[model samples]
Target: MQLKGKRVLITGGTRGIGRCMIQELIDQGVSHIGIIARDKKSLKELSEGYPEVKFIRIAGDVANIDILREAAARIEDKWGYLDVLINNAGIVSAGPTEELLDEDIYDQVAVNYTAILLLTKYCIPLLKNAEESAILNISSGLGLIGMPFYSVYGSTKAAVRQFSDSMRRELAPFNISVTCSFPTATDTDMMQKFEGVEMDTPEYVAKKSIEGLVNKELHVIFGGEQRIKDVEMNFSDPKKFDAQVAKTYDQFKQSSEGHKAM
Candidate 1:
């Protein structure tokens, strides 16, 4: 649907791809946005940067159920309807699963999966109240193809992909749509730990992802043709895909060393 004058609620909209998506929403004429993030100061700066827009800043960690509840309540109390809900907040803790810290694993699941479920659950009514509504979930390329060291991160994203599909079908009768985007090694704060990896710009990813939502596209898969082929290979030829992954197992392990962006 067209974004002009639409009201949106997004998580972690103050930094990384989420930040760029906020800018994209503004460019598409969205005037009212509700943002949930941990940094109150960053939320204030975001509002100042975009004086023409109305921002409902809920500064708290999305992993907190209370914060998710607060966001939906505030939106209903103010706007009464929502045109878009962007589940853009995510965290990654990489490395071999057995070697990973317990807290990091729990945090990844909480921030990357539980938040989406809780926030989306809370916003369903507001979405149905609108003339048309859409949900944009940001998954990862790793979610499409399992990798060695990114088990937790990939699982959370894969859950997002599955949730998007389920929600799309469930909300079809209500004139609501869901779009899931799979971005690979995006150049964002989440990728800061990687030493050397060619990545997609957060700006480009944000633009395409938003376009997918507006156009009602089912899936916005990044990483070009190779990523598509990899996904196909993993699904069609598990043994072959395993062999290919085995060849680069060491590389993934090395790159993911101490990777934490929570």
Candidate 2:
């Protein structure tokens, strides 16, 4: 669907991909934009930067039911319909699943998986009113192939990918498109927590996402050509893929141990 004059709502719109997409959408002439995030300061900053554009800023955590419901109510009250819903808010808690705290698992699942599900359900009514609408779920490359040291985080993202698949098929009758993005390490705060990995810029990921949406691509892989090839290979040969991942994990472990010794 064309973004010009479209009403869009993006969760976690203060930073990273969400923030970049907000700016991109404005540049493309979206008529109404709503931002749901926890940072009032960032929202104010954006609002100031784009003084002529009116962005509905609802400051709250997307994981909370009350906050989500209130945001939904405000959106419905203001525009009565949304042309795009971007489920871009997610939390990643890396490290071994065995060492994961209960809170880590719960919070990751809440923000990454549950929040998207709830927000999508809440906005379906409003979405139905639009001429042609879209829902974009930002998953991760880890979701496509599980690796060592990130089991909990990977599981949550995997859930998101699966949900997007099912939701896309279910919502097809309503003329609403659902697109799931599988991006590799992105240069966001979340990636900062994971040391020594190459990352993609949020702007690049946001641009690719919009391009995929416009093209109606079901699965938008945002990790350049090599990662895309790896994903395809994993899908084509599960046993060989698992062995390769195991070998890589062993090398990473040895490297970490050597660093600690130093």
Candidate 3:
């Protein structure tokens, strides 16, 4: 589970927590990284910023199946195997589900859920080729506790959590570990629209998540003790959780208004 000398592939590694993770990986001694991001300029900048690291930059949208396939194919041709796969790219468009745009919903699903599934499918062979490998999936706190005004985003993240669990067991025989991270209200470009709220720094979240992957931990959950208590209450006493949600319904709706990052 050591990151030293590992060949890692990550999505959206050019910005926010993903970018911080790239730094964490380098700090942990990873030298070869394959990054999938939408901006060609950012990818180029990343390569330039870390001259010592060998970066395989694939500039394109993760939502595209072709882009995902291309990334896997490129990695196979160049590295033959992959030691780690980090599914970190994500998009969010929030509001009341009834008022949300259809296109935005589709985009969120394609980017956050389908891309993870397809990219992981394509990389399994490459991962198996390695002596030992690992997968880290970035989910959300909302995934654990289904909150209002974020149905689609939360569902996609919840899917990631499920996929991580299933893959952890399915890939056990192959010596591939799977880790899922649930981060809440992170202070990143993704949450720029929200103001006056306490949040976890992206650096802290990235550091912890990378540590979780290296330690082979199954889950790296943010949001502290309260989040855990809420998750427990949501699962064991749905009606009780509903009443809590009802209390903050207005705040949730207002925060979600025009909150989007894609």
Candidate 4:
């Protein structure tokens, strides 16, 4: 969808890819941009920087259905409708499944999957009102191929990918496009926590996302083309894919440790 003068709502817009996308949308002449994030201080700072843009900063946890409902109400009250909804809030916790805490698993699922489900349900009415609407879901290469130590995170993203696909079919009658963006390691704070991982910049991912929206692409894979190919190849054999991912995870962990020593 053309972003010019569109009303967009981005969740988790405090930092990383969300922040980059918000700025990019503004640069594209999107006038009404609503950002939902837990960091009030950072939202305040962002509002101060872009005083001309219509920056609606609602500080709340996306995991809470009540908070999401409230945010949707505010959006409907302010703009009446939204042209784009970017579900970018996500969290990753690494550990062996046996050792992974239940709370961590729940939090990851809540923020990454459940929250998106709730937000989309609430926003569908608003999106239906727009002349052309789009739902952009931030998934990952891991969503297709499960990586060891990141199984929980990967599973959540996998759900997002499938959810977006289903929603796309369901919302097609309304002309509300759904774009599932599968990005490889991006140079955001999340990737920084992994240290030596090679990653694309948030700007790069944001650009690809915007391009996908403009072209009305249903699926977008950014960063490593090889990784996307691998995902496609493994779609038929998940067990084999998991084994390969385990090997890659070991190598990545070793590289991260080596970098830390330097």
* TM value for model 2: 0.93
How close to the true structure is residue 68 of candidate 4, measured as C-alpha lDDT? 92
Writing each residue's lDDT as its tens digit, candidate 3 over 68-89 gives 9999999999999999999999
* Number of backbone-clashing residue pairs for each candidate, in the order shown: 0, 0, 0, 0
Better of 2 and 3 by TM-score: 3
Residue 162's C-alpha lDDT in candidate 2? 96
lDDT of 1 by residue, 42-156 (tens): 9999999998999999999999999999999999999999999999999988888899999999999999999999999999999999999999999999888888888989999
Higher lDDT: candidate 1 or 3? 3
lDDT of 4: 0.84
Candidate 1: Cα lDDT at 214: 98
What lDDT does each candidate get? 0.94, 0.83, 0.94, 0.84
TM-score of each: 0.99, 0.93, 0.99, 0.93
C-alpha-based local distance difference test score of model 1: 0.94
Which candidate ranks first by lDDT, i.e. highest? 3
lDDT, candidate 4, at 208: 89
On TM-score, the stronger of 1 and 2 is 1
Which residue pairs in candidate 4 collide? Answer: none
Candidate 3 wrongly placed segments (more than 4 Å):
none
Give the poorly placed runs of model 2, Cα more than 4 Å off.
250-262
